[model samples]
Target: MTEIPAVENAITIRDLVVDYGTRRILDGINLDIPAGQIMVIMGGSGAGKSTLLRCILGLKKPTSGSINILGTEVNGVRARDMHALRKQMGVAFQGGALFSSMSVAENIQLPLREHTRLDETTIEIMTRIKLDMVNMLPHEHLMPAELSGGMTKRTALARAIIMDPKLLFFDEPSSGLDPSTSAELDELIIMLKNSMRMTIIVITHELDSVFKIADHIAVIGEGRILETGTPEQIRASTNLEVQDLLHRKARETVVDADAHLRRLVGEEE
Candidate 1:
């Protein structure tokens, strides 16, 4: 990442609200991610976790609120400024998102090629270093389809950090892997944080992965943050919804017959 003034928090979000047409997704969210810490955002399906990630990633605009990433407000930053700021960040998308046509080395080199004016030799050296970091150097010549799921994830991780991004984002890093593979990936995540000192934001609901890597965890539900704390605090939380989620218990929704009918008729607000 580019040299910038140091700050206590890498990301600060306040009164963030996002809506899609008539339905609200994120309602009144406030969060501060401390610098160089691993913050995990976990939630059940349709819990607005992904929506909030989008807002922070600058992929979508919110209905109302402010998002400060790396001390720069993202809502209306100048185009050039935003470009510069984004150079400090990187995202490892879900399912790897590697181009099927590109080799692993090529994929990792994409960012450097797009962002910098380095020569081919330096870019090649950088790409190889990243691949070695992720234990993917041996497979650098393979295409996306030729690699296993774990290999794919490792390659994506290498690409995310190839630029030495100040803030790194991971989406479902352990999603499709087996137990042992997941554990290995979790270890790599911690090792990277320790070695690189990059502030990482992981969006995942996997409990084992969460316990292993997260410095702090935020539980989101129903388009809002339900709780934010250390893993132990989250485990000890007294909130009914939190407990339900932690135990993987099915939510019991009591019926309001009249209100239900009204909602079905588009009458409930």
Candidate 2:
């Protein structure tokens, strides 16, 4: 058997907690994502996967604990410093969150235009390079609404990698794609990891994609992690919650049906 090589830790979290008023979204979470590897976070709907992604992206401040990305503590970094940190990161939003008013070339050029003093010729060259990398160069003149679902995703990815960010995040990469398109996106993800040497974090409940691309996976449930391990380890996990999520089975559908109905009827305290 061949032994896998270990990489340095790229993102580390300790005792992470997030809350909304009295409702807790993440509870005492801890994780370490290694450099130059793909880490997928999988969970059922409302299982706090998106909240955790937001916390990791510095979009939402956690209620407590630490998130260290590329050696900088992210809990309360100054705005100037946060802006600097963001320049090193990129996010591919779910549903291909491209600008409605911009062409593919324009959208991909937006970041380089805003962040760098690079001239038009250089910016256009960079945009073309990324568009080619994502196999979207042919559609650079198209608008967001004119692209297919997979094309939209690839275009969004082209924009994400335009700056060659050290850390890249993707949310629901294959959410609305057909099976073949989803597999193609999965291949593209693996190629990005192998060729770019980027520390990638993906948030998805898609089991097939998770098993296909994740070097390691963290299974989250109800604001907490049930297990974190390699794809094989996760597949072999005996934890009920992990199994439930992987098999798309609800863990507790009627645990409190009468109380839930009473609450809907305004009869509960």
Candidate 3:
């Protein structure tokens, strides 16, 4: 018998809680995301998925517990140190959040300019490289408003990876796209994971996306994690909430006239 190598975790959250006034948005979240793996946070609407992402990004302070990312405590870090810590992450917002005023190339170059002392020519080369990575090199001169929804999303992804951060966070990567387009995005995500070897945490509810790309998933409900497992594990889970959630989308309709009639007659009686 051979012992398996121990995997290193990129993120660790223990007893995490977040409160907005009296409302508890996240309650005692405990999660571990292994290094260089694509982990997904999934749930229905208002399930605190985004809150958990924000907490991990250090945008929101935890009321209790700890969030350790790349061996640094997120909540307790100093402001200057926190800024440095944040540089290790790349985030893609839900709406593609690109600057309407800037060309795709300019938008991608923004982070490089801010963070690096590289000359203009070097930044241009780096920007083009990232755009090429996302297959948006041809659209470099186009502005956000000039691109299609899918292209805009790809451009946002290009900008996200321009700095080559250690961690990548995506908010609803497949939102507002047709099934085929969504699937395309899924393929792109898979390619990014393999090529970049960076830890990825995506907040999404798209089942197709989840099944396609998630190495592990944390299902959130009522501001807490209901379960965390691989797609196969989640599909075979006995937890009713998990079952209902995973199956509801695929449930078929069956006529039950006799049952309906019985209930109606019982009510009359």
Off by over 4 Å in 2: 1-6, 249-269
Residue 141, model 3: Cα distance from true site in angstroms: 1.0
Expressed as tens digits, the lDDT of each residue in 192-254 for candidate 2 is 999998888999877779999999999999999899999999999999999977766332422
What TM-score should be assigned to candidate 1? Answer: 0.89
Kindly indicate the candidate among 1 and 3 with the higher TM-score: 3
Order of all candidates by TM-score, from best down to worst?
Answer: 3, 2, 1
Task: For residues 144-166, write the lDDT of model 1, one tens digit per residue.
Answer: 99999999999999999999999
Q: Which 10-residue window in model 2 sums to the lowest lDDT?
A: 246-255
lDDT, candidate 3, 72-168, per-residue tens: 9887799998888888899999999999999999998998888889998889888888888788898899988899888888888888888888899
What lDDT does the true structure give each of the candidates?
Answer: 0.90, 0.90, 0.88
User: What residue runs in model 3 are displaced by over 4 Å at the alpha carbon?
Assistant: 251-269
Model 3 quality (TM-score): 0.91
Question: How far does residue 259 in candidate 1 sit from its true spot (Å)?
Answer: 38
* lDDT score for candidate 1 against the true structure: 0.90
